[model samples]
Target: MKITKLETVIPRDIMPGLLALRIHTDAGHIGHGETYYVPEAVASTIHDWMAKRLLGANPLEIESHWRFLYERTTNFGSRGCELRAISAIDLALWDILGQVCDQPVWQLLGGRSQDKIPVYNSSAGPSYAGKSNEPHDSHVWPGHGCVGHEGPLNDYWSVVNRPTEYVQELLDEGYRAVKMWTLDFAAHKHGGPLYLSKQDLEVGLRPMRAIRDAFGNQIEIMLDGHGFFQLPTAVRIAKAMREIDPLWLEDVIRPDCVDTIADFRRQTDVPLAVSEMMIGMEDYRLVLEKRAADYIMIDPTWVGGISQTHRICNMAQSYNVPVVMHDCTGPLTLLSGLQVGTATTNVAWQETVRSQIRMIYPKLISGTIQVEAGYAHASDEPGIGGRWLPELFEGSTYQHRVSEAGR
Candidate 1:
């Protein structure tokens, strides 16, 4: 069916300003997709920049549409919001394809290779949801894209006090893997340069030591560096953590510095996982070519949707490197990526904010993502598997709705 209209809705209560797009077909079928976390930039890119090209196009020609947009945007700021809009649209097209075909998206993705996706708790704290209103204004979780400060009053990490106790609680709730920021935006919080003191280093290490001591071999601990360190400092922390033996160290060095990442890999045996912020294949190519990281972390929403994620996972498989889909952002990203995980053999873990998702998901969409003992099942419904329940947005002043006649 031809795509007749493209609509965008900015939910007033949910994220206040983030954009969610719906692709409308002549057959009256609709598919939903969400772009990057930042609302204004992505909204403009989708509503004003890209919608004109999409109107009346064949919704089923996913690959052709994706390539057409990619080739044209090369000279027109190809990366940031531009790529994110393409990502949102690509995801929605796949959703429309599944609906028309009467099959779940994962089955269309080449059937399930996994029954459920292995998961790791984002450990962003007990109250990580709805903070998207102030999105980057967090007191416990590390920020995405750039470093963000956490206010002193609700420093959830400190509130937990005992790291093992914090982790054991997750284990008790049925999580086998756990990930948290060991050092992040500390420079912003401390009002100093990006150097960590002896005391500062120990403070970060305390949680690692606690988990290692408590579980030994039962739980896997992953550390998030949030691109917080220089190469030397990153190497030092990697060296120190080698004593505790983490599953992998993530985004330890600024992901842009390919040479520094290579250097860190050479200096220590600590397994490396790079940023989900990487949008270009060459950025990932450099890491894989140099054997810089043991794992590739991809956020389909940031990198261009299911199509790009499938290509990246295939590339990683050729290198014998594993792929993990990141979740600490939007539900569409999480749900779509998890569906990919069900079909992608090279995938290892899917990140989840347990407290955030279990409560918020039912309110926003029709499908249920059930998690049991550290693993999550993919949605079985046809299409992209999510049917948006619109009534939830009934009366919110902050909401903005735009249709293809043009917002």
Candidate 2:
């Protein structure tokens, strides 16, 4: 079926960085996709540029459409919003393919590799959802510094202030792993990532040490540095983290230089999970080639959606390195990760912010994501599983942009 229209909606009141994309086809199938951060720019790319390549094209030709968009954008630098826009469109195309074939996305991607995958909790609160009213700069940076109330699911705040209690709660709830960004505060306090004092380093390690003291080996601890540290500081953090024996240190430094990451990895005993910041396959290829990361993190939405995610996962598999799906962004992002994570044999963990899943996700999407114990099951439903709620587009505060074929 030919694609007839492409539409995007950004919620102005809540979750402002979220952009919900819909591809309408002549065959009555409407495929849904979404990407987080920079909604206005992503929406513009979808309508003003990417829409022309998609309109009137065969909706099921997912690969051709993906390639066409990628090739054109790379000539002009394809990262950030451009690649994110392509990622949303790629997801929509796959969703349409799943619907047309009457199969779930996981099944369409070579059936299930596993029944379920283990999930790791990331310390995030409801405020992590997005900033209200602000369309741009919607991402919430870590470290509230005693700002908000101690509500349930406000794990980010709790983790720093009440580390022992937070670990106990997650352990009681069946989570085997938990990730935090407590070091970010030090990075900002030090004026930059260039330096970290002995005092601040001790402060940063306190929560992590508390978790190990209280729960010991009961829960796996992962530290996210938010790509904020320079080499010397990142090395120091990694060296200190060795005491706790974390599951992995993720993005302790940026993934900008594979050679530098390789250098860092050589210096530390702590296993490093490289990054989700790598935009596409080419970025990932270098990471794999350099042997930089012990585990590779891929954000399905940010890494060009399911198509590129699958390719990267396989490439990592070739290196015998496990894949971890990154999804602290949005529901479609989490759902898209599940679809591919369940189908990829080497995938190790799927990251989840329980706060976002329970507090923010239900407001925007229509279906429930099944997570029992610590394992998440892929949706058996066709086309990316959950659809964005019709009411999400009905609000007066929601902004809509569209591109129709032959316009």
Candidate 3:
């Protein structure tokens, strides 16, 4: 079927907003896709830059469209928002293909690999990033759950004020794992450079000791480096975490530095979860060849779309490396990531800001994708949900809207 119209849908209610692609076709089918971002800009990129490329093209040509949008942007851009725009469109095209064939997106990718994959709570809040501190309001961030929440739940999750109680609640909820951060305050909140003194190091690591004391071996805890620490400090932290037997240490020394990552890996026996910033297979191939990480985290939103992500997963699978999909970006990122997670064989775990289960997602979108007992199930819906309520568009409108190709 020919693509008839192109538009961007933004659910204003969602924190930071989710910029989604809506591709309507002559076959009476519409596909939904998304990019993690500033919705307005991503939306503009889709309409102003990508729409004409897709307007009259066959909607089912996912790979062809992906290449077209990607190749054309070679000089101007490729990796960042340009790739993000293409990612959203690629997913939308897949949604259309799934609808055309009367199969769910997951099934079309490769059939359900498992009823549900194992998952780890990101200990984040409603912002889609894990919360560092418990939000006083209903809000919680989806940042790495490194920070703690006090007096209920708070924003900016770091080490929780009551690690014992928090871990207890997560275990009670049937969650098998949790990922929290311990280094962001020094790197992100403290203005400039990270300088951890002896006391600072102890304070940074206090949560790890508490979490170990609280859960012991019963619960799997993952540590996030936020990719913000110096190599020496990262190595020290990784070596220290060995005592707790963490599930994995993530982005400890920044992912782009293969040597630094390798050095960190060498210094500590702690299992490592490498970067999610991977975009193409070439980079993934190099990381795998170098053996920089025991587990590789891929954020499909930042990487390529489902198509590229699948390629990356298969590449990782060839090396016997486990793939972990990240979802702290936004709703479509979570949905599409889970779709890939459900269909891929090597994806060991899926990351989520667990707090979204409460109010964020329900209030943000017209569709629903739930995480049950710490695992997420794929939606049986024909296409990704993009029929946003008009209320979501109250003060906004599509940056550029295209009519049906055959109209």
* Sliding window of 10 residues with minimal summed lDDT for model 2: 131-140
- Please rank every candidate by lDDT, starting with the best: 2, 1, 3
The list of candidate 1 runs beyond 4 A from truth reads: 126-129, 132-160, 189-194, 392-398, 405-407
- Which candidate would rank higher by TM-score, 1 or 3? 1
Winner on TM-score between 1 and 2 is 2
List lDDT for all candidates, in order. Answer: 0.76, 0.87, 0.72
Candidate 3 wrong stretches, greater than 4 Å = 128-159, 189-194, 384-407
User: Which window of 10 residues has the lowest lDDT sum in candidate 3?
Assistant: 131-140
**Across residues 195-297, which tens digit of lDDT does each residue of candidate 2 receive?**
8887898988999999998888989999998888889999989888889899999998888998999999999989999789988788888988988999999
Cα lDDT tens digits, model 1, 1-407, are 68888766665455433467788988988878877566777877777767777887889999998998888889866788888888889889989988888988889989999999899887663234344333453444424322223432222453136567667777887988888775664534553125666676786778778888878878888888877677877877887888778889998877888878988999999999986967888789988998889999998877888888888988998999999998766678888888888888989999887655765556567767667899988788777777667774355453554646433
TM-score of every model? 0.90, 0.96, 0.88
Best by lDDT: 2
Tell me, by TM-score, which candidate is best.
Answer: 2
Better of 1 and 3 by lDDT: 1
User: Candidate 3's residue-wise lDDT over 212-296, tens digit each?
Assistant: 8866788888888777777877777776777778989988776777877877787788989887876656678888898889999
Q: Provide the lDDT at 247 for model 3.
A: 87
Cα-lDDT of candidate 2: 0.87
lDDT (Cα) of model 1: 0.76
